[model samples]
Target: MRILVLSDLHANVTALDAVLEAAQGRWEQSVCLGDVVGYGPDPNEVTARLRKLGTQTIRGNHDKAVAGVMPTDDFNPVAKAAVDWTRAQLTPEHLSWLAALPPGPLATDGIVLVHGAFQDEDEYVFTPAQALDGLLDSTAEVTFFGHTHHQGGFSYQDSRLEVLQIHPRPTESFAALRIEAPRRYLLNPGSIGQPRDGDPRAAFAIADLDHQTVEFWRVSYDISSVQERMRQARLPEPLVQRLMLGR
Candidate 1:
């Protein structure tokens, strides 16, 4: 079955809509790596959409903070502001759903899904050492994670580690890679709502389990619309600017 792997959807429904349109009829099952809300203008709408789609999701740091499972003390000022705004926007039903999201690493069909590192759900596995540590500790051959929002990950084979990056052209929709045996992978599909890969386009991945291949896709959305909403909502300027810069 083809699985749509989505992560870090920071409530930008426009980006999610574009990704869904681009990936239409291409996936059989959808799994979210979390952060369904927080940082964008449409927290409730995004959460409702994900729920309607029946996405099997894990909890992200932002989700945890918004749901009151985690404190916002560690968050930056802009993030705290966004989370606070999101908290006010979410309905009781959506808030309950967000609060009830399961923490990862969740295993399904031999693959593991996590918001951060395998050892710690709140950890950020950005460096090679961190990724390698998680790979060495994890028994799962394939682990999909989000948190850093970068569209790449590390592969471990025979005690050697290699970092992978997907720098697709503007015209290109996706970059495909084979999932070889005897090698363990820690893949990050980047962020759907907020991307920090220096590319403004929204990022996601399609794992073709039947063919043993993974395709990383980047889809462009209406950033201006999201920015306008954020501005109207009085979110921080940096948050609005980052969407255009993809930082």
Candidate 2:
């Protein structure tokens, strides 16, 4: 099956739409890694669309804050403000939907989907060492995770781990590696909204089970509109500026 892996959408509808449009009927299943809300415009629209898409979404830190499951004080000052604004913007039904989201790492069919690290659902596993540590503890051979908003993967070979950086260009083809089925891996699909990897484009992943390859894809959307919305909504200017340069 072809699965489209998405995470850290952070409620940017334009980026979400860009990802769906780029999928172009190639995906059989849409798997969301988490963070459906936070630090972006159009939280309602993004959440509603994902619900209609019937995505397998897990809970994100931002989602937790919006649902009031996590303390707003846990977030930074600006993040706390955005969380407060996001909570006010959401409907009761939307909050319920977010409240109902399950925490990860979830296993299905041979793949493990997680919001953060395997040890903790909220842990941010951004480094190769961190990814390797999670892989060592996971049960699934293909463990997909999202949190750091950086696209990368780590594979174990001959008792040594090799970290692979996911090339964002769709035109660049990758050779399928012979995965040992029961071994473990930790893969990040990257962030859809507010990419912080020095690239402003929307980031996602396409897992082709049949081909044994996970292709990371990035698509450009109207960042200007999202910025405009943030300004109009009176959200933090720093958060709005980050989207432009993807820093």
Candidate 3:
């Protein structure tokens, strides 16, 4: 079974569409780690498209805030501002869907999915120690996650843990990892809308379960459209500008 892993859509229809187009007929299913809204211009369109795709998506922090289930006060000034703006842009139905989404680490056959760390969906698992701690806590043999907006994964061999940190480069090749038996693994596919790893490209991952291999992927999208949308919506200019720098 091939599973196309995605996360942090962040309301960019362009990136989502590019990922989908790139994976057309290549995977049997697509799974999203969440953040379907916030920071981008097309919240409704993105949500509607994901719903139409029948993708299994979880509730991200931004999604929770928009649903009114999460407090925006804890967010930074710009993030708080963006969340406040996003909340107003969503329809009642969209709000309901966002509210209805399940928080993860949700496990399925050969894969575990989460919007953030298993300890807390809103927590950051950015460092090797943090990722190792999360891997120690989870029972899943292989876990896929997002939230730091960085493309990385951790592996445990015998009793040792190793971290894979991917840097963005054109024509980059993915590392193929093998899952033996039922050991623990935690993987991040990176961000789709707001990449924070100093790369201005869309990030994702692909898992071919049948072959027991997983690979990371990144692609460039029309960032200008998202910036324009932010302008039209009057979201924080810095939030919009940051997308270009992938900060």
Encode model 1's per-residue lDDT on 1-247: one tens digit a residue. 8889999999999999999999999998899998999899999889988999998999999999999999999999999999999999999999999999999989876678999988888899888988986677666788899999999899999879999877667899999978998788999999999899899999999998679898999999999999999999998999999999999
lDDT on C-alpha atoms for all candidate structures: 0.92, 0.85, 0.83
TM-score of each: 0.98, 0.94, 0.94
> How many clashing pairs per prediction, in order?
0, 0, 0
| Residue-level lDDT tens digits of model 2 in 132-183 | 7678877777988888888777877557887876655545422233455545
Task: Score candidate 3 by TM-score against the native.
Answer: 0.94
Candidate 1 residue runs with Cα over 4 Å from true position: none
Candidate 1 weakest ten by summed lDDT: 132-141
Off by over 4 Å in 3: 173-175, 180-183
Residue 166, candidate 1: C-alpha displacement in angstroms? 1.7
Superposed model 2: Cα runs more than 4 Å off: 169-183
**Whole-model lDDT, model 2:** 0.85
- Tens digit per residue, CA lDDT, model 3, 100-144: 999997876657788887888999887777887667777667788
